[model samples]
Target: MRARRTPEPYLWLLFSGGGVVAALLLPVLVLIFGVLAPLGVIEPPPAARVRALLDPLLVRLALAAVVGLCLFHAAHRIRFTVEEMTRGGRLDVVLAPLCYGAALTGTVIAVLVLF
Candidate 1:
């Protein structure tokens, strides 16, 4: 008799946990920092400076982080969707590249805005 092995469900659980955390944190962080901070609603000791405090490098870095995480998360979700809707597994091969490509496109746009 051969021994049976069950894959760990915790991997998916962790991924889901991290994804949800990022999804929630990203938008809230943006709204607070980008909108509220600019509007002068929430003030810290330094008194949340407006756009005057931002630099091009910081903006581009923020854009890249948001874009990269969103693109990766979206790609995984889309892959799962395709898998559920179809009976074949061929689509899995292209999911990663497609997602990365979208991320790269966003990064390029961000870079362009920075310059």
Candidate 2:
């Protein structure tokens, strides 16, 4: 099955949305978790406090959306990059599913874990 043809538009939409979401969220996430939290600029909260922050349904849903979209973005980029490097569009069949399926799987996992 040609995964690209059936879902071309939707995939592109998701790719773009994911890029935007990742661009906006990733740096902040890194700054908080990777830099400030480690450097003691912002204290890392206790596990209970983290749990409390994630206790809300709305927050969980938003985080799931962000994770899903970012996964989609990465899948799109990797799929195309592979195809381009091979100098043929022939791999789109395998690449689309392999990439997007992984993204979908990750999204499902995020939803499961978050909710």
Candidate 3:
């Protein structure tokens, strides 16, 4: 028996969407536990150790990578959405470079912020 291979475009869509959902939700969850609960107004959740997240160098690299990849992922997803809505003409030409350019800019900003 042979396994089926999914198309690359669909796979990228799924991965990008999932990553966005996770990234968005995580901050909310963190705020709920880290700040809200600590104020004693909301029910408190158990604390989890985040020692690794506290390292400045590691944090900067991680933030930079996250920002860059996320922007690229977002660009692809948004471009597709725009394509569906507008339906044609030079979309790829305009969007592809913009996406890459934004990602590169984010990477440079991250490097500056980190350093």
Best by TM-score: 2
TM-score-based ranking: 2, 3, 1
What TM-score do all the candidates reach, one by one?
A: 0.49, 0.87, 0.55
Q: Which regions in candidate 3 have their CA more than 4 angstroms from the true location?
A: 1-26, 29-55
RMSD of each: 7.2, 3.1, 7.7
Model 2 / residue 80 / CA error / Å: 0.3
lDDT of 1 by residue, 27-112 (tens): 88778878887788876325345344444667657656655556555655666777678864777568646754675687577667
Off by over 4 Å in 2: 1-5, 39-41
Worst ten in a row by lDDT for model 1: 6-15
Q: Which residue pairs come into collision in candidate 2?
A: none
Task: Give a tens-digit lDDT track for model 2, residues 1-115.
Answer: 6555467789999999999999989998999889999899988877899899899999999999999999999999999998999896998888889999999999999999997
Taken over the whole model, the C-alpha lDDT of each candidate is: 0.61, 0.93, 0.66
Error (Å) of candidate 3 at residue 71 is 1.2
How badly does each model clash, as a count of residue pairs? 0, 0, 0
Backbone clashes (count) for model 1: 0
Global CA lDDT computed for model 2? 0.93
Greater lDDT among 1 and 2 belongs to: 2
